[model samples]
Every structure is written in structure tokens, then in C-alpha cells.
Target: MRHQPFETWLLFDDPLTPDQARALDEHLRACETCRALGHSWRSVASLFQASPDLEPAPGFANRWKARLVQEDQGVLTARYRWQSWITLILIANGVSLLGMLLGMTFFDTFDSLTEILLVLVYRLTSLLTVINIFQNLLAILIRTIPGLLSPSGWAILALIVSSGSLLWVLSMARLARMPGRA
Candidate 1:
């Protein structure tokens, strides 16, 4: 049986059936591209096996466990900060909407339709404000988190934030550049 080029290379990593293995072997023998690919895969696998495995210093695991705890605490603290901000924003918006409704009803102002429209506008504005505030607070917290100053901590934080930002930007750019929703 014949196999496609990718399948031939893929079989190198698995327990191939006798016929599959024979097919791949024949293909590699005749095709320089497949042969080179097989050789490269073997070279990578051999290097991984031959590399030295270094044991960590005494108490290394304990130290790592302690660091992990610290990182976890930092993450919890960050989450709490954001949660508090969101709660506050939500409460404030809810109160504002309640007050607006009370004021409108007590004063007996505007027709029913006008009152409904005004309330809708007020709700939308409040929602936008809450989102804006939350984003700003989150940015500030990410920038100020103290653990981020450590080399490893900074790398971890940067990797997380940068990848998130890159993905957001890429998605937005893709949307903007698309021909149409279709």
C-alpha cells in the first residue's frame, strides 16, 4: 500500500504495521525528501536521549514549592483586586440606575416612551463606564503587581500578558482586514 509523504514521516514516531512500515521504508529509500525528513527526526530523537540530565541542588524541590505558593498567593491577590473593583462598579451602576428611576417616577416627567428611551441611554452609559473602569483598573494592577519584579516572575507575567495582548490585537486586526462577515 502507498502512503502520502506526511503519513510516511508520521509513522516514524509510532508502532507501524508491517505493511505500513515496509511501505515507508520503500518510500524513504526512493525519495530523498522523505529520507532527509526521516534522518532529521532520528537526529532530534537521538539528541534528546543523549542530553545530560542534571539533578537539582539539595532542597531544590522545597524551594520551588515555596515559590509556587508565593506565585499562587500573588495570583489570588490579583484576582481579589479585580473582583473588588468589578463589584464596586456594579454596585455603583445599580444604585445610579435605581436613583434615576426613582427620580423620574417621583417627578412624573416625560411621556412613557421618552422615559423608557432615557432609561435605556442611562443604562448603556453606565455599562460602558463600568467596562472602561474595569479595564483601567486591571491594567494598573498588572503593572503594579510586585512579584512581577523578580526575573522569573517578570518572564511569566510578560509571557502571559504579551501573548494575551498579541492575540487580542491579531484578532482585532484580522476582523478589521476581513472582506466582509458574509
Candidate 2:
């Protein structure tokens, strides 16, 4: 017959039947190999049962929680440190670039800028010269306008203007009185 299953008898959590125990005992008596294996297995099982279950030290959970909080604070502080440095670096670079641009515009391009400004002023002066000529001619015409008109000519112009205004008022009144006009 094959060797009895000694491992099942030794390692099972529940007690075995009487027939299985008797059969395992008979096999162990006949087979020295199986008997030695069972004895070693029993010793291992007894050692495991004798040892205590794993557990944390006292206040272990509270200490771990405190460590986690410290670690989080460290990470946040590092992140903010880098953020502040980046912002300061960007602002410094921007200010330096603006300063350099102003220096270049005023120092290196000063002569060319002055020439361009002089050209603009010359063009504006020429334009103002033409405007002054037109203004003088308009003044001369305004001064001669009264001399060009006689007393009878002024009277005739006033009469015509009065008649035209009266005609416009009568037309507006007639339109306002018309049906569907309101």
C-alpha cells in the first residue's frame, strides 16, 4: 500500500477520524521515513503554535500618523520654495530685459531716433505753412465780404430768408394735421 498521508493528520485544523489516526499510526510504525517526516512536521507545528502573533509596538499608530503629517509638511514646503524662486526669477528676468531694452533704445539708437524726429518735425512745419496761407486768404475774404454786399443787397437777402422760413413752417404744420401722420 502507498504511504499514509501523515501531513494531513498533522496540519489539519479539525481533528481526524479514529480510522485515519489508526491508519497513520500503522504506517508510521512500518515506515521509518514517514515516521521521521511526521515527527519533524509536529515539531514545526508546535513551534508555530507556541510563538505569539505579530503586532505593532505601543503608540505605533499615533507615531506613524505624526510622521505622515511631518512628511506632508516637508513636501509642501519644498514645493512652495521652488514656486517662490521661479516667480522671483521670472520677475528679475523681466525687469532686466526692460532695463536693457530702454538702455539700447536711448543709447544705441539715439542718433537715428533724433533724425527720424527731425524729419517728422520738418513735414509738420511744411503742413503748418500751407495751413497758414489758407488761413490768411480766408481772413482777407472775410474782411471783404461786407464791402462786397450793398445795403439793398442785404435787404433783399433778409427778405428771401424770412420767406423761406415761413414757407417751411407752413409745410410742417400741414403735414402734422394730415391723417395717419401722427
lDDT of each: 0.83, 0.87
* lDDT, residue 27, model 1: 78
| Candidate 2 clashing pairs, residues 3+ apart or interchain | none
Candidate 2 residue-wise lDDT, 3-75, digit = tens: 5367667556778799988887887788887778778888998999999989998999999999999999899
Per-residue lDDT value at 78 in model 2: 100
Tens-digit per-residue lDDT, 28-130, candidate 1 = 7777766776678889889999999898889999999999999998998999999999999999999999999999775686567778788889999999999
Residue runs of model 1 more than 4 Å from their true location after superposition: 1-52, 109-182
Clashes of each: 0, 0
Model 2 residue runs over 4 Å out of place are: 53-62, 81-182
